[model samples]
Target: MTAPTPRAILEYGLSSGNVGLVQLLGLCPLLAVSNNAVNALGLGLATVLALTATNTAVAGIRRLTRRDVRIPAFILVIAAVVTSIELAMRAWLPALHAVLGLFIPLIVTNCALMGRAEAFASRHDPARAALDGFATGLGFLWVLLALGAVRELAGEGSLFAGAGHLLGLPGLELVAAGYPGFVPAVLPIGAFLALAGLVALRQGWRLRRAGAGA
Candidate 1:
């Protein structure tokens, strides 16, 4: 198959081919940590970094690896990259890292990482692979942001609370004072409910577009 164009990359990886909506990768952390905007963006940024670095490294070393051992090689590369990301988070974003916990290291197992490696980066050049990685991560990030924001507003009556701790940007947390949040939204069931609503909304939009086209 031919490599996707830059615009196509963005459209698919960020919008049409959204990891949450379409590909449905990395749901473990998605449902667990998306209680607020801060956690979502923090993990999203980390995943973005992992994806970009993993893609670039995989593409850079593709020519040297044997075809038969490619899968293992990719795994090892991804592990190393994810570890590096984890350490950086621990050092600079300790609070966010603690909140995220095991999920940080679990990035190595995210199918999105491996999928991009074998499907795109292995065949494409580094620059294109990097672009694809960023786009893909952006897609995932957008979902995380939406989910986190919605849950925070509904569950805790606040927005972006504790957000700055991740990026060290003050004033990121916004509190909706005097609002009594829905408790269910902060629980595991709440993640499912919120995710279901999001998926439904996306499908509704697609259906509307189809009807318009028809």
Candidate 2:
């Protein structure tokens, strides 16, 4: 494969090698916390923070770690970072943090974070690692936002419900008017169904665009 440029790296993170698309990692939290925009944004930001910190730290210490034990060491760094973020969330954003629940700690297990650390961060400079982390994290964030928007609109007939709390604007519950909510759209199974449909739609669009270009 050709060497990845900075722009290419960013593009890959925003789309192609996205945790949901290329790596297919962290689906559990992706589906679980994506019930609303606020929840999705919170989880997405946490994940980005975890990935960036872990990747940067790993890259900085790459020469110090033995190859055989690198994976464990990486996990240790990730766990510590995730735990720190989890504590911060619990202490400050208790309500939003509660909505995320176990998934916050679960960021440690998210293969996306580890995958980037092992695959990219281990071999790259700190600057490159930071870029990779931001790109990959942003990619994951985009998907979570899309999924959350779909779920929230369909499930609750709203968007960004309870967003003001996160922004420190207390007592704001933004609800759309005259909306018909579909309860199943917010459920676990609904996440799978929606994701599958989106995949299908994306495929169809790709095929149609290819045909037109041809």
Candidate 3:
């Protein structure tokens, strides 16, 4: 097979590394803030911004950074970008900033960000590096949204609770009363169980599809 193009590299990063599904990076905020869709979306957006900025910056300076010091330089760059994002979030989206809490700053330490910077951005052109970051970030966001939906539905018997506050759109509320239980969808244990179940379900679906194709 011919060598994969930069665009293909990015697509693989998103679908394969899969900060949520495969690599399982950034699980702390994934489980914690995912109690609600708005919370998850807020963090996911921040992460995407941080990743894109870091990747681009790193790519731009890759030529100047020496091989021995590249890793530290990459981290410093990522941290600076994440800090800027954190400050912006604090200024404009204070409520979301509050809900996200430490995780906002913690994006600096997220391996997924650093990994992309070191593995992809350092070796690729700026455009491709940025695309890789965007793809990976989007993949991460998708899983966070799905997890938030499942948890919110099970925990509160509703989807998008308090969504108006996040979306800043009026009269867009979804609520379902008579909720049975919240134990399996709000707790840390619940997060683990839910994630495990999702993995198993995906595996089963893949297996079934394979069998059908055969």
Colliding residue pairs in candidate 2:
none
Clashes of each: 1, 0, 0
Residue 40 C-alpha lDDT in model 1: 91
lDDT of 1: 0.90
| Per-prediction TM-score | 0.96, 0.92, 0.91
Per lDDT, the best of the predicted structures is 1
lDDT of 3 by residue, 74-189 (tens): 98898889889999988887877887889999988788998889888888889888888988898888888888888878887877777677567436557886778586687777
Candidate 3's C-alpha runs over 4 A off are 1-3
lDDT of 1 at 22: 84
Name the regions of candidate 1 deviating beyond 4 angstroms.
none
Q: Rank the candidates by lDDT, best first.
A: 1, 2, 3
Model 1: lDDT of residue 147 = 89
